[model samples]
Structure formats: C-alpha cells, structure tokens
Target: MTQDKTNFTSQQDRLPPQSIEAEEVILGGIMLDPSAMSRISDRLSADAFYINAHKDIYQAALRLYSQGLPTDLLCITNWLSDNGLLFRIGGRNKLASLVDRTVSAVNIDVLADLVMEKYQRRQLILAGTEIVQLGYATETDLPVILDEAEQKVYSIASEHSASDLVHISHALADTFTEIEARHTGKGSPAASSGFYDLDNILGGGFRKGRLYVLAARPSVGKSALAGNLALNVAKTGKMPICVFSLEMSTDEYVQRFLSSESGIENNFLETGNVSDSQWQPLSVAIAQLSEQQIFINDESCPSLNEIRSQVRRISSHYGGVGLVIIDYLQLMALDTDSRVNMAQRVGEISRGLKRLAKDLDVPVLALSQLNREVEHRNDKRPVLSDLKDSGAVEQDSDVVIMLYREEMYNPDTPDRGIAELVVRKQRNGPTGTVKLLFDHQFTRFKNLSRGRSF
Candidate 1:
C-alpha cells in the first residue's frame, strides 16, 4: 500500500499539467483555456498587461503540442506570443532537454514546489504585487480581485416578467421631493406655461419622464409650440434638456430660438422686418444660451440605441441630462424590416423612450402625429385615441399631452388662437386641460398670464 501510494503520486506528477489546470490558476479556480478566458473577458477589450506562471521547456512543449504547434523552442515562444503569453526563445530547448534529463532525479514533491515557486516569481516580475498577501497576487492563490462600483451596477439584474403589469406602485413614500411648491408628490404640479385655468385643471405642468405627444394637421405650428416649451425650460434653466429635431436643421432651430428670445416674429427674421434696436435682445439671448447646457441633436431620424449612446455620452461629459424632446415618434426607426405594423414599431420606440427615461432618471417629451380621426371629429381637438400608430403610448406614458388650437381648424371662432394643452392621461395625477397663449410674434407660448409676468 505504501509503494502503491508512491507510484500513484509519481504517475500523477509525470502526466503533465492539464491546460485546464494551468488555466484554473490563470483565471479562477475553475477549468478554462486562455482562449476561453479571453472570450469570457470580453476580448480583453481594455489595455491590460498581466503575467502568468512560468513553465519548463517540456511543459511548454506539451502546451504547444496541445495547441497544435511544433514542439520546437522557437515554435513554443511564437505560440505563447500569439496566444498573449510571451517568453524568451533561447530557454525552451534547454528546458526541454532538462525535463528529459532530470525526470528521474526530480521527486514529485520537488517538481510541484518548483512549479508553484516559478508561478510566484513570474507574477512578482510582471505585477508589482506581494504574492503572499491575501489580495495582491496574480499567478498563485487566486488572481488578486477587487470590485468596482460601476461593475456592481451591471452585475445585478432581475428576471423580467413575461408581460408588464401597469399597476405602478403609487406608494409615493419619500422618493418624491418637492421640485416645485404646492406639489406634494412626484407628478408634474407646475402649470405648463400656458393658461392659468388650464394649469389649475391639469394640476401643474408636464410630468417627469412622461412622453408628451403633439400632433397636428399639415402646418399648425407643431414645431413652433414644441420649440416654445423647450425654450421656456432652457430660458428658465428649468432643467437640463435635449431637442431631437428630425425635420429641421440646427440653424433653422436656432432661428426659432432667436425668435422666442427676442420676442420677434419669424416673419420679421425672414423678411428683415425687425428694427435694429431689437437686435440687442436677440444678442443677449444668444449669449445667455451659449452659456447654458441645453442641447440640440438634429438628426433626421435616430435609432433608439444610437440615441441612448448619445445620451450616455452627453450625461458623462455634461454632468447628466434631464429632459429629452423628440420631435415626433413615428419617424423613429424600427428594429428591422420585418413586416410589423407601424403601431408595433411606434410601441417599441415609445417603450424604449420610457425605459430610457427610467434608466437615466429623466423626463422624455416626445411629439407625435395625431390620427386623421381627430380632424374628422366635430371638436377637432385631439384625444388619447388620436395618438398616431400606438395606443401603447398612452399606456406607457405617465402623462399624455396633446396640442389643439381651435383656430387651426376653424378660421373664424371665439377660440381662434387659443391653444389647448390637454393632459389626456396622467398615470399618477389628475387628468385635465390647460390653456396657453400662442404669441405669433415670438412664435412661442406662455401661461395665459402668470408668475414672473410675461
């Protein structure tokens, strides 16, 4: 039994280290090859240089043979280099000869000790770490591992449900901080800069993270009204914002901003009707805006991922993004050219925007096209159903706001120029309407009459 134990140890020692065993030390204690580890490490996407256990010429040859390379010294060095572990060439054949020469003289215990020592030496040389310490060694005793805050963020994820439940826990708790006065919860409580009665009815302004869709017939100031609200937020420094203009250029959009800031009509800017004295206000507004963090990304159409990436970049570089405005949702790109209905594609886009808002913890304001059913109705005012393409928009949004100017459809009416800000759905608050004053001169809208007095 004693002789059998000796022979068993000797045989195990002579059999050579398994590629899986070597990799066990390289990565975690589990078995894996370098290629497998590399893939598991996401292609080693960042620049990182680390060393591993040193192998003898015979062991190197075994590795080379397993990897389908020539069993020669040069080939061994080249293989290591190609696979990202590198060593000098001259030592290989000498070590191989030593392995064959010293095999009988070497005891199993001595060889194991040598292998362990060499691993420590290599790790010490490559990484300036104390191998004996609990958390600093690489080659032996578990690669020194540490956790990062950002990685912890990605490592955690929950099993998503097969279907969504709309029962948002309305338990406001204390997560709701009063961003404005007179509001005790998370929903928008500031009257939109439209009409006072409308503000009182709608219970304030647009809610955070809610997708506000505005649709209109051919040319009923869609851009104008959207621009007006966006500029109001910018001018007031209300919150960090973004404007995705699918239909206009940055230059044209700037023209609209200039009109709003100067209280000058677009017609004046286009036809030179503005007096020279008015240039001062435009200049001041321009200078002030240059210092503010309001952003405008005017791509004709952007994919949801592309937008997410852009938002990530903006947030990282610009100290976080707040409000996001998409000119229209129907223009968003569908994931693929499968013959899916427009409504499904719109739903996907709407869902994506909502997720993005929650993920980034910001509000998303999107413009939408109203179905012609709105036009056919006697009221001509848009309702939740009039939202183009997707009823999902109403379902997913915390608030759904639609714009309808009575004058847009009727040439001569008492409400001629009166724009109604209808809150079609308030996921967490009262649903109602607000009226806004549409000033053609500035091409902007404001509360009919209110705070800081327009």
Candidate 2:
C-alpha cells in the first residue's frame, strides 16, 4: 500500500499544474455562445491550456471568431478537420466530450480565470526553478543575475496586464466630456510647456504617454528649451517634473533655472556680481522656485534599465512624475552582448525611451544633438534626418521639434536672438514653426510678444 501511494504521488507530480476541466468548460462555452470568446480573449490565451487537444481546439475557435465566422460546435469541428488538426487533437469524439461536460455558458469568465490562474502558477514554478539555478551559478555577477530574475518576473506580471478594448461609442462619450470640461475651464488638462504659441500648435499640450524629441545642433538651445519646459511644468505644482541631465551638473541646471526665472544674466549670477537692481528679482526667483516641485538628477552615465528604475522610484513618492526630461538621447546606454552597430544600439535606446513613456503614462522630452552634416548645408535648418546615430529616433517619436536660429549662422541678420521652434514631425497634428525669443544671457526661451514679428 505504501509503494502504491508513492507511485501515485510520482504520477501527480509529473503532470504540469493545469485544470483540464476548466479549459473544457471555457472552450465549450465559446462553442455554445460565440460572444463568450470576446469576453475572455484578454484574460486567457491558447498557451494557457495544458492539454494538447484543448489548445488546438481553442486556437481554431479563435481563428473562426476573428474571421467573423460562427464558433459553434460544428464550425469548430469542421475548422479543426479542414486544418488537419482534428486527428491530432483526438478527432470528433473529444470535441463532443467538451460540449457534454459544459453545463452552462454563463460562467465562462470564471472558468477563464481558473485556467489563467493555473497557467500563472505553472509559470511561477518554472521561474522559481530558474532563479534557483541562477543562485547556484558562481560565474555570473550577482547583480546581473538579480536583474535578470526581476525582469523575468516582471514580464509575467506585464503579460497578465493586457489591455482591454473600449467600444467606440464609449470612447467618444469620454472625449466629448473632456471637451466640455476644457470649454468651461473645469478640467486640469495635460501639462503644457508654458509657451502659448507652441502649446496651441500642439493641439493643447504635451499629452500623457507621448515621446517628444527635441534635436538641435550644438549651442542652438535644446537643453535650455528642456529646462524652460521643466521649470514651467513644475511651476504649476500639479505634478513634479524630473530632469535627468547626463552632460550638465545639477548646479549648472539650477543656475540656468535661476537666470531664466529672474531675467538676470547667468554671468552676473555665476560671479556673484549681481547689480543692486538684479538682487531683488534673484531673491524672488529663488523663493518662487523653492516653492515648486522640481527634481533633477545629473548622473553622468546610466543604462536604460537604471533610468526606468529611478523614474519609477521618483514617481512612487507623489501623484507621479508628470514629465520626464532626458538631457540628450545619445548619452543614454544600452546592454548588448552581441556585436551590434552604433546605429542599432541607438535605435534600441530610442525604442526603450518610447516604451518607458507609455509604460509610465507620462510625456518624455528627450534632447538630441543634430549631426554635423547640417552645418555643411546652405540653409543650416535641422531636419528629421539629422537626428544623430539612429533613424529609429524619428520612427519611435510621437513629436519631433527642431531648433533653428539663423542668427547663429549670420550674426548680422534681423532674426538674431530669435529661435525658431520648428515642429518637424507631429503624428497627430500639422507641422509648422513657432518663433520664441532666445535670451542666451539668461538661458531662457519666451513666447514671442504679439505684434512683434520675427
């Protein structure tokens, strides 16, 4: 009797954790009511089934439902036969068994949850085993192993959080409500960069879950523009803006903010040579900025993974990080063991930044330096192609703004001190240029005054 019990326990352990009865119920419900498939699609997938026959049948049902065809018992059987999977899936007899076992279609969602739960448990077992193996390995760095283990678990969690589709009518109703609120000035809309003309051209403001790229040649004021936007967003006090400066120090960033806020020359502030008239504005600027919520990190080099982790930490403190600004894109790092080209690494970094924005549900304003090729051109206007290192930078970006100043090329031109905010690529709106006055002394960008033509 003891030997018999041991044999039974061994057989049970050999079988992967799964609920075959629940899978059958889910498949049968879909056959009984085609609409049941739509309700459970987001919660379960074919791989969730432990039995081969059940997996094949569920796949067929999905194909039929997706093709706008019925998923009734006969249709699924015929689909399996036509696809040459019927015999492999235990033929018609097994299909009939599923229909007989299912009592009702009302609890399809509940059955799907059961199947998903079993599948996740199996996944956890596998992931835990891998972690154990990694713990035993002595060659790999402990930190790297830990990172990989965390990523494995995160992937499972992320997969379970699949998005559900909303009906068009419901989506439209929500949009209409938002519009009404905006019309009445009742809603606090997405944060803007505080430049009215630029915001107006952008259809309101920098929306959540968007990646905006600002590229310019050296000294054209991309970093300054990023700082200006950061300061403006923080001034609202609705949410904090986190700026990661790879090139500039935190002190330099703060000084730029002070000069921009006080309309005082950075040179005067840097040397503590402020005039009597400038001291009052400086003090006021200090007081105003000290009241706002602005976070800055001037880490010289950080990988994409590190940046994501840091952003998540900062976001956990308050409502969340409303906006993320990276001083430049090319400065960010990526991990790769294989021999990849520079452009490919840059592409990976760009795509990672876009994913980070969407995952955090916030706008990421990343600065980039334009290629030197722009200088050889006659116009010297930076274009989308000039985004250094990778073409994916353009492909992944929702909006691309380039900075142009003819004064840099020709000091005698009347456009001196005027920076052109060129909307080179806008996915959801028109592309045009909005001029802003660039005061290099204060390291600030301001909306051009009305009736003052550039």
Candidate 3:
C-alpha cells in the first residue's frame, strides 16, 4: 500500500495538466485553413500549447498573421526557417505531419479553448507550488506571505488574453443598449453623489472604471465629501462601498457618517454629548447604517499592493463593490527606493490607483491635498496644478473635483455656509462649479436652496 501511494504521488508530480492532441489540432488547423488564425488569435497564444515544438510553430504562424501575411503551411515553414526555429520545432516534416493529421479547421476554436483550459490548469498548479514555498519561508512576515500567496492565485484566476479590435457596429450596439437601459429606467451606468447639482455637473455621477480626484487644502471637507458620497452610494446602490481610511480611524469615519445621517453634530458625537432628542434620530441612523454595505479599512500608511489585495477580497466576498474611496491619497505608502522623489512616487501611486479602478470596474474616489501655493494666490480655489506632488493625478483621473469653502480661508465671506465643488477637469463632460450647502456642525453637504445666492 505504501509503495502504491508513493508511485501515485510520483506520477502526479511528473505530469502537469496538458492536452497534446488539442494543441496539435489547433496548430495544424491554423496551417490547414488560412482563416483559422483570425478565429483563435485573440483567444489563444503560443504559450497555451504545452509542447515546446507546438509553441514554436504557433508563434511562427502568429508572426505571419501579424505581418498581414497568410499563415499557411508554406508561410509558417519559411518564417520558422528564417527565424532559425524550423529545426528546433522538428523541422519541415513536423509541419507537414500536423497538416496531414488535421482534416479541417472546423473545431479549431473549441480546440483552442481546450488548450487554454489546460494551460490555465498548469498555471494554477505552478501557483500552488509557489504558494507552498511561500508558506515555508518563515523569514517573511505572515501577512506578507499571505498576501503574496493570494496574489499568486488571484493572478491566475483573473488572467485575460489580449483583446482584439471591435468593429464600430458592435461598439454602437453596446452603446445603444446602455442608452436604452437608461431610457427605460433600468438604471444609469453611474452612482449619484447624492448632491443634485453635482450629479448634473458630473454628467450623471461618478462612472465605473474611472478615477475621481477630490482635491482641497487642509480642512476643506474633501474627506467629509468622500464620506458623504460613500454613504450615499452604499444607501442607493446594491453593491458594497469600500473605504480605505489611511488618515483616520474607522471609528472616526463611522462617527462622521452617523453625524451626517442623524443630523447630529460631529463634535457632539465625538464627545458623546448627544442631547435627549438627538438619541431618536441617532438610533434611526445607526439602524440605517447597520444595513448599508460599507466596508472600512483603517490601516495606516498601507501600500498599494495591500489595498488592491483587500479590495479584491472584499469584492469577491460581496459579489462586487460599487465604489472604493481612499480617505486621502498622500498618506498611502509606496514601496520604492529612497532616491525616488516624492512627486514621482505620487505619480506612480495615482497611476496604480487608476489601474486598480479599471481592473475592478468600479469608481475610485481618491481624496488629495492641494499644495500651499493655493494659499499664497489671491484666489484660494485649487486648480489642476495644485495637485500635490504629481501632475499624473490630473492626467490619469477622469474627473477632478476641487472642494473650495471660502469660509475656510475667509471666515466672514458671503460663502460662509456654501461650498463650491469646482469641476476643474472632466474628461467626458463640461467643467463648471456646483454649489452646495456645507453644514459644518454635522460635517455633511447638501443641495443648495433653489434661490440661494451663496
């Protein structure tokens, strides 16, 4: 029994998942039919073939196809010969054999899919082996090891082939479908900021796969605005909202949300000084908030990789997230050499966040700090150039909303109770300012009155 078990283990270890027949059929089919390459080029790559010789042949054919040449047997042979890979792939006889074995290219697509499945299985096995090695490395921190293991597995699961170009007709069809959905009241492909005028200025609201930078000077209510928007999305959208509170504790953020929802002063909540009448609304707000799907990570100075891993875990658990809000961008940690400048570090962070938004297909609202240069200027309102440490913030973001409260700088100004959300850079829509009522006490923002001046 022991010998049999050892033999079984050895056999399993030697043979990784593969389908040589399917790989051969695909390689042969591409040469047999000139049009077969087009059908599977996007779905299959040379790496998907388990056999090295097949990988070489398929790669040769791909080279031909890329150069606008037909991937017939003769072309593949000549290309492989010119590249000195003909002998490495078993020479011209190997190509002839594949063609002779393949009757037609009818099943090439299905065969390609099978080869890809085998490839993915092999990849998963390799990932598992690496994960096992990671487990044994006690020198590394436990969280780091776990994160590396999860990333290894996640990469395999989320791997995608390079996309092919789509014709305009197909693009138009998708656009019209989305438009029809909105026209029929199904839903818009955006999440409203819960402020009416702001929504209008944002086309509808924050869109999926886009980074929205909310920049302001210190204490200008960017964090408050992000919290409010996150709460609004959690309340309205069916999907969960993730908040990475790099600057504040989760308790602090929850208190602000409670203050906004219950109409209680944030200071009162922080101090546990709620009045008798405030208890009722506070209770109601707590109940409402308890039902909302909002996940907060109050990790201080978390790196981008850590954030991505947490977001992926939360998204996997809750089906998907509607939005991801980073409390403040500057505070997030970046692992880089000491020689790298802060500006370049920040640019890398912004680009990484943009890519994260795209990968998760959710809107990412990142709160940023404006440089003090705005303070020296006559107009305290921030512009794209005021984005601290990086211009990539403006270049990568789809929308840049600068929060300006004149009261912050000039306490006696007419806009004491008003907040201006200057839509400075909008990639897809008009740029303008949307005014809202800023309630300093409750740390909340609301739509301005119809006839209100400031």
Which residue runs of candidate 2 sit more than 4 Å off their true CA positions? 1-161, 275-283, 333-339, 450-454
Work out the TM-score per prediction. 0.58, 0.69, 0.82
Residue 453 lDDT (model 3): 13
Better of 2 and 3 by TM-score: 3
Superposition-based RMSD of candidate 1 using all C-alpha atoms, in angstroms? 17.2
RMSD of candidates 1 onward, in order = 17.2, 6.5, 5.1
lDDT of 2 by residue, 232-304 (tens): 8887536888899998999999999999989898998889898989889999999999987888889887677
Candidate 3, 371-441: lDDT as tens digits:
88998999888889999988888999999999999888888898788999999999999999999998989
List candidate 1 stretches off by more than 4 Å.
Answer: 1-208, 272-274, 334-338, 451-454
Model 3 Cα shift for residue 406 (angstroms): 2.9
- What local distance difference test score does each model get? 0.57, 0.83, 0.85
State each candidate's clash count: 10, 0, 0
lDDT for position 355 in model 3: 96
* lDDT of prediction 1: 0.57
Q: Which candidate number would show the highest TM-score if scored against the true structure?
A: 3
Worst 10 residues of 1 by lDDT: 42-51
